[model samples]
Target: MQQDIRDKFKNYKEENVELSKNHSIKFEALLQQELHQNKPKKNYIKWLSVAASVMLLVSIGIQFYPNKTSEPIITKNDNDTTTKQITLGNISPEFNTIETYYTNSINLEISQLDLSDENKELVDSYLLKIAELTKEYKNLTQELNTKGVNDATIDALIRNLQLRLQLLQRLKKQLNEFKNLNTKQNELQII
Candidate 1:
């Protein structure tokens, strides 16, 4: 199929060559006229001046009519020496607030639960471990912030929290199971 197409193209080229030879004089004159017209004119300086003026006007227009900001231009000073305002870019406040609320809720829930002294001591130790872990997490987070870590650290921290949360859930489940067992044993003794 390709060879057939190539043969057809070769025939077309031969035909075109023959046609071109017959009209070569007329073609040459037309080509010369086109080339003369296409060549840079004596008015090149005038056209260049016009183009430069247009570019200058466009530059001036850009300086004046820049794309309008969606947000207000919060300026530090009247001079164009101001910075762009990025909205709510920092997450420290939101993170801190949420963490505080979550930790407080956990503490409150733990305090409201009744348990034996032994179990209470165990829970206290677990809480202390969590506190230590949280402190270390905070220190690491601060270090990452100082070193300009990417959002990967945030993702890692979230994953760690998820793991910790799973562990805590398991601990709570076990604690509940232990409490139920203890209650049943006490009832059996009473019986």
Candidate 2:
């Protein structure tokens, strides 16, 4: 059927066809109408883009502003003295960099966790320990502010952060092992 159609088309000859006298004029009018219609859409998109840019600038500005309540707070103690709660990051730029790196990594790991009923118990136990460490970290920061900076306190704070990260890593490793073991058991049952 396709071959017959192909042969018929091959045998066909071109024949001139006449267009209406007003065809070019109508086509030009249509093109003008389309161009005018398209222009308003482009302007709408331009305004939308401008709005997005303004919002982005405002958001970036807000990000740079210091957040007061969620973090270290200033408390006035004794006679006419304001003392801000001390933190590891506030201690030094180096400590701040280290602390930031560890915090970001820990948060990233937690965010990526694959939570399921199979790993709930394990995850909960590890999280409980992390919570305890977090409390201890807060205590040590308080101690640092109260008794002033000590080598032991600094070391303990650093260690606490290390332990939290390590616990998350261990939890991840155990979850992977559990999944692999379960997969193998299912494969065995299938056989």
Candidate 3:
């Protein structure tokens, strides 16, 4: 029985089968038909996407475009031959009042300082500090013009003014103390 099973296994042979030429041609035709059927759908989707993108870009451009009628009129000063600049004072009545008040207060504090020969260096140092603060204030004003009124910038502008006034007041007080000290030293020397 074992010899019979071995003989049957040795006699078995695998068959090599392949698709006929006619079936191969039919398969290729079916594949081309499927691709042709889907081509229009793919092109339609591509054109639809491009059209949507163009509409989106046009809407964004429209939103960013400045309106000519609402634009501010900028008139050059004839006498100075310089362009007039805008500031927070021009933005609103409330801001104008606040700006005017701070400016006047800062000027008053500056004018009250005793800028004698002895105190010239001290005064100059304070002036330099004030000038730096003024530059920062100008930057804040430009920011306000570009970004419009916001709490952070408004507070910064006001704080800059306050700091300038405080610096001037402190300088004045120090100068007065220096004068008193000098007067006392002169009296002691004479005695």
Index of the highest-lDDT prediction: 2
After superposition, the stretches of candidate 3 with alpha carbons farther than 4 Å from their true spots are: 1-86
Model 1, 24-122: lDDT tens digits are 799889999988886556898999999999999999998767333323334455476664432212344454444455555556655555566858776
lDDT of each: 0.62, 0.86, 0.82
**Backbone clash count, each prediction separately:** 0, 0, 0
**Which 10 consecutive residues of model 1 have the lowest summed lDDT?**
83-92
| TM-score for each candidate, following the candidate numbering | 0.42, 0.59, 0.54
lDDT of 2 at 140: 95
lDDT-sorted candidate list, best first: 2, 3, 1
- Per-residue lDDT of candidate 2, residues 1-191 (tens digit): 34677777897999999999999999999999988774444577889999999999999999877644234545869798778777888776677777888888889889878889988999999899999999999999899999988889999999999999999998999889999999999999999
Global local distance difference test of model 1? 0.62
Higher TM-score: candidate 2 or 3? 2
Model 2 steric clash pairs: none
**Cα RMSDs of all predictions?**
14.1, 12.0, 15.7
